[model samples]
Target: MTARANTVAVGYLHALLDYARARGLALDALRAALPFDPSDRDARVPEALGAALFDRAAALLEDDALGLHVGEQVRPGHYGALGFVAMNCERLGEALDALRRYQALVIDLGGVGLKRDEQTCTLSWNPGTDGPYRQLAEFNLAGLVTFARWMAGAWAKPLRIDVMYAAPADTREHTRILGCPLRFAQACYRVVLPIDALDAPLIQPDPAMRELMQRLADQQLRALPRGDDWLTRLRAQIARRLRQPPVELDAVAAALALSSRSLQRRLQAEGLRFSALVEQVRRELAERHLADASLDLADIALLLGYSEQSAFQRAFKRWTGQTPAQWRAAHTEPRN
Candidate 1:
């Protein structure tokens, strides 16, 4: 009914739950009126509940490794129908497609993308919502690599791993589990897949079974309740398109399958304006891009869709009451 019901995969919570149970944590304390059935490991829960669970677990453990441990421990089966669809696909490429297509059944936050070229394939991830769990980006990639090793081959190492976070002081652990060279604080978190891995045959490929799994996944996905928040959808579309110049109202309306007039009226009904949303999305993206040490102020400006660096500077000043460089200097961490 409410946007609060926007779903997240239960596995994220289940991981914390598993660790807590293993350490004799009073699971009952963390089980406050959660929207998902506690007994169903494969269930989807309201996003609020998932966030709450992560908060509680972090408070209890006080260790960053908790999420990393959970990621490594997530068996392919833990993903439920999504995992089933992926594992049953005929080859590594098909498996990746299944994961991308059915990922909504697991988490409503970020979408997955796969781009293949003559030499290699790249898998890019963008977090859906801003939270500590978004930092679980690392864990999510680690889990995929975990699955990659199983589906592709043990020797199916990545060409490189790019993260949005700054490089850890010691990346041996990342290299150990992720099994790849690391690039940190760049554009976003990405996995560069090896070419040989793409066409590698999956051990459990069954085309018929994959079809059956897809049908079941579709049924299950349809059964899940979706968020009724128009604002959330609008914001998501805007954010996804901010990199493109002059994100037109007509384009966004078309993406939502609505007439421009209807989209305008609906946004007005929610006490929002199309121009206001554009500003909000651009501001958020600007702040995020500025944090990446790899990107210069000019590049950040262009990424946020301004044709000129000066125009972007003017807009950034209006949004944050500081020029882009000033904001970066004040808000971003100093390099060692």
Candidate 2:
């Protein structure tokens, strides 16, 4: 997807603009450097603009601490409200539910969803009406984990992050910033935290305040900013189809209530082919499954719409230079 409809990146750009203004930089000057049209209120700002902003901001600043300040400006009440919600919840599950409900309010670029398995609670992202932003997605995941730790009064342990995107060439900064097990190019953007984390009581709790925050969060979710793009809408539809594997293109078109030809035409207009997008989804899922050693290769292959394990392996190798096992070994670590 073109950068314009990437909510995470756009939100980060918005945050950067605000930061520059706060630092006495001219708003017009900042706008001039960006690709977005300042005069067009409805115009979508590209994700490239956000990337450029981050790169420039990172270079201009002396340290990464400035990024935290920028994040605060981007989502002002995010951490405070999370702390309030955690303290008020009766149990860890309740707190997680509250976090799921409120996370969107902090930034509507992407929404966070929770799934509980027998061993861990997985926090995943449900891309909003906007397409995904790789960097913004990374930042959001990192920020949420850090905020959750702060709320629980446990800053010593790191949150487990699994990303759908491939691992970057440079891992030192990412590892240093996250301080947790990092798996890249996974099937989904998620964090797998031990169930025990939920039982750790909050440092502060107030039922009345938590309820009030919940009300505020609900209101915010209702008023979230939405994207106006075919790619954004199509990505959401593709995500839904992944659950019930072996999705046919025509079926997806029918689900969107558009003719198959029309769907194809629309996707083409957006510079994307439906098949390519489906492959992208499969690649993401493959990466995730490959990282988890417990998941057998055949099972992962079946889940990703591949008929044979060899086919899945070949595809995985094409996506990343290394074999799936090699990639996982390079990324995974023993749980502390």
Candidate 3:
């Protein structure tokens, strides 16, 4: 993992540890089992190691939906200076704009983009050089979606979340975690919600806080470090795995040099299950296949871990609420 990836992973782990402590989990025991010093603010661990830790935590807790809980734990206040910006922004759009403007002050692996349609607003990511893990990516996206929804509900109307990701194997679990429509793939990774959501005023609307946060964010942006290529590595790993069928969790874990159980547990702690991550990978592959005119549906299905086309069809419907063919038709427009 690159420095950026390390920072993101560390921040996520920190959040998880905080949650564990609050939940009465044996933090010391879990910390001791981890590879890096949890207390060391500058401690840098391999991205793979960070991922392994996430997996181990999830499995150890025996909570397949741990990611959802983790998402819920992220509050605007948790982001420190960034939190201040979010809290003080006049509306959801302003807050998101602030996030987009200064996210690099917090994480380096990616940047976020806000895309709006007549009925929906989509927050998408442009992965930085150090590519991020699908789980981490999902966790980050889900956390933002959950936070936005909570904020919106507190202020005004609630927005429904729509997640577009690289599909995962455990479609059921992914649906359960998101508690909304989860599209495997069509184009980019995004969280879609109604445009009306932007109108919701933040609960903590203070112009002074917003100004203070803006100043703090400006300072942090100037001092942030830039290194590591985790996002690139993650993209390569996904592409490679998709090209090769039946990519097992254990194989991925072994490549990272950790026990399968440990890997699963750590991912759980980060708010991801291995199965969900795998499905995300598959969803991306499916989208790629669907976009290629030459690749038949059956062939794409086999490449994406489905034993048969029928199974793939069922999964596709569950993922997008539309058949593969239907999704392709809707998304095959020329971009300007």
Candidate 4:
């Protein structure tokens, strides 16, 4: 896999396929396009492929809400160790916290964020630049809701739902499955709930089992082969925080749970400097956005955290010996 590649557990792929088969949809074409060994249940697949499978299955079944439906079928096994850890967590909050910490074991496409206040809490999904793929985003949000309901009770439901995309033509399935007021075209995708719900006791709260599963999950996290190294992780952190403002050393260090001095030392050990890596990430993202052929140089500059298009233009020239427009003209195909 490439440095930026993201992957998901194979179990999720199987779950989607299983849902498709149950609905009498044939899998021949899907298998041909994105083949995977059905026997390799313990393996991982590219997250892109998983998203594609969701898209293909939705098309084949003619179900716009396919991700939501497939997510409803998620069982503990689908998430691997993290699932069991959540299953044994004493409180709903504990379960979600575990998910936040160890979710990369199941999917590494983006991030899961949790925030709380006195009266309410929000769980948000921040997908990558390539996504907020409508079906995949629904799957992620629906899977969380389904897992929460299974762990807490049938009464469990989000207070409101916020989706990053425009409202679909049909929202009946969303309303039926999510059972909440829905907001669309928001800054991010979120599930909002009463804060008290976080304290609700799970149906099965086994402290001993939770501890055991947590150990296994920690081991799995340490063993993750993709982009787990310090340098790669730092680049990813820089990429994420670029648009959030104050993309400085202290901020990036805090995100990585390292002091600025320590972070600098680590980078030095890798024969790198923090500033250099940040610039590298910006250049990479600039190229990626430029490849779309829809984003103008100014938009790409802002996305890369530039205060001015001129600053980005200068940096791009430094990185690639060409102006942003010049590079785009040479590298990307013109739109029809």
Off by over 4 Å in 1: 1-6, 29-36, 40-43, 46-48, 132-135, 167-170, 228-336
The TM-scores, one per candidate, come to 0.62, 0.53, 0.57, 0.67
Q: Highest TM-score among the candidates is held by which one?
A: 4
Which candidate order results from sorting by lDDT in descending order? 4, 1, 3, 2
Residue lDDT tens for model 4, 208-319:
6876787799798878786545555787899998886667999888988889998876654333456656765776688778878879888988898889999999988865
- Number of the top lDDT candidate: 4
Using lDDT as the yardstick, the better of models 2 and 3 is: 3
Which candidate, 1 or 2, has the higher lDDT?
1
lDDT of 4: 0.77
Q: Encode model 2's per-residue lDDT on 1-336: one tens digit a residue.
A: 323344322433455666766787666554434766544432345544555555555555543444445543444233445446655764555567666555544444343555544667666653432323455555565566555655575632445877666666666656665677888865456677776665666656665676576556556544556555454466667866775676678988887788999887665433345766777567656765776778888888777777788987898876555677776665455445
Question: Which of the two, 3 or 4, has more TM-score?
Answer: 4
lDDT of 3 by residue, 1-336 (tens): 222344543554576677666777776557644767677643445555655555556666766445556666786654657767877876787777677656655454354555556787666654422333555555565576667666665432224343334565566755554556665543345565677767777767776667677778768765666554332333345557764666777777676666788766545433344555556557656865787767889899878767789999998886555799886765454335
- Lowest lDDT sum, 10 consecutive residues, model 2, at 1-10
Q: For each candidate, what is the lDDT?
A: 0.69, 0.58, 0.60, 0.77
Instruction: Give one digit per residue, the lDDT tens place, for model 1 in 89-189.
Output: 76787677667656777776344556656788777654434443533555577777888778778645789987767765656668778877888765555
lDDT of 3 at 132: 36
Q: Lowest-lDDT window of 10 residues in candidate 4?
A: 265-274
